[model samples]
Target: MKWGLLGGTFDPIHMGHLRCAEEIREIFELNRIVFIPASKSPHKLDAEITSFYHRAQMVRLAIEGNPSFSFSDVEHQRAGKSYSIETVEYFLNKYLKSIEIYFILGQDAFQAIQTWKEWQKLLLLCNFAVLTRPGYENMGLSGALPEEFSAQFTYDEKTSGYRGPTGHHIYFRKVTFLDISSSDIRSRVRHGKSITYLTPDPVRHYIQKNNLFQMD
Candidate 1:
């Protein structure tokens, strides 16, 4: 049971988000990928995030017809600011019988793991699948591997290829870089700019119809 966890605020799910999930699933032979929209993201506290219902609905719309992709409201159900380590632990405890979780994150996010709460314990609970854009090859663990988990680090280029399961190994997958961002999309909508390609067409329509992101 290899499951991929793709967590984000998902202000509105976009093409890059979908592509990343599809490519990763194909490349890693993942059984399924769960899109977990944060109820309250700890990192983006200053940003004006959409409601949990809106974000979760957008994720549901984005992954609609894909059997291999699904949405989870675990983070939304939890109290306080969302933390990756706590979310991973929730899955571990709930699916203790046959669960193997792989948390997927972008290179930029992965670089900031040192500052996350209980980050060291997270590595032991689930493997990390770091998604890198164009020029980020030399992007793995550095400095030190905590105190007791030094030998757990392993590198393999084959895991980046578009076949076979990466299993429980931590890896970096190089992907086509798209500079599209949720923040930019929100701003565009606020300024009456077209965000057609930046997000899914339906999601764009939803935003416009609901008059979201518009501010004085």
Candidate 2:
């Protein structure tokens, strides 16, 4: 089975995230896409994020209508910060060799690959589908892949992406470019502003019901 794994803090899963996942699933013909909310992010330690239980619930509410979309608490179950390499390793072990895992991320995030922990090994573990963010011109890998690992991939004209030495592929996908963000939603909610169209109805309801993001 072809599976796509998209992990993030998902402080509150919004429409932008859901749109990208849906597009990636359709583009890659993925059997399913799992939205894994991080227990704690290594990079965002200084930032105050929503609780894992709330984030997980929001993710569940965001993708409730789609059968192909599902949520996982893999990171929450594990201790300490969630790393992509560990998540990939866990999936590899669980599925054996029967599953093809595609790691879905944004172009901006992909550009900072060099900063990630064991990024080189993480790249070779699964196919990467980097979605283009709004206001980012040029959707290809020419300026995307870091210089350190640039030698590892050779552009394949047919595939319109790069193929790694270890058989992993990096695809630059163009998805629905929504400018929405969780930070903005939080700010809006804190200021008593309506976030009606920013996220799914269920998620919005969940946040309001739980009084999330409101200032103390």
lDDT of 2 by residue, 1-216 (tens): 999999999988898999889999999999999999999899898899888999999999899889999889998899998898999999999889589999999888887777888988998888999987766675465576656667788888888778999887999888878899999999999999999989999999999999999998
Residue 38 in model 2: lDDT: 94
Worst 10 residues of 1 by lDDT: 159-168
Candidate 2 lDDT (Cα, whole model)?
0.89
Best by TM-score: 2
In model 1, the clashing pairs are none
Evaluate all candidate structures by whole-model CA lDDT and list the values in order. 0.79, 0.89
Look at candidate 2 and tell me the lDDT of residue 90.
Answer: 93
State the lDDT at 61 in candidate 1.
79
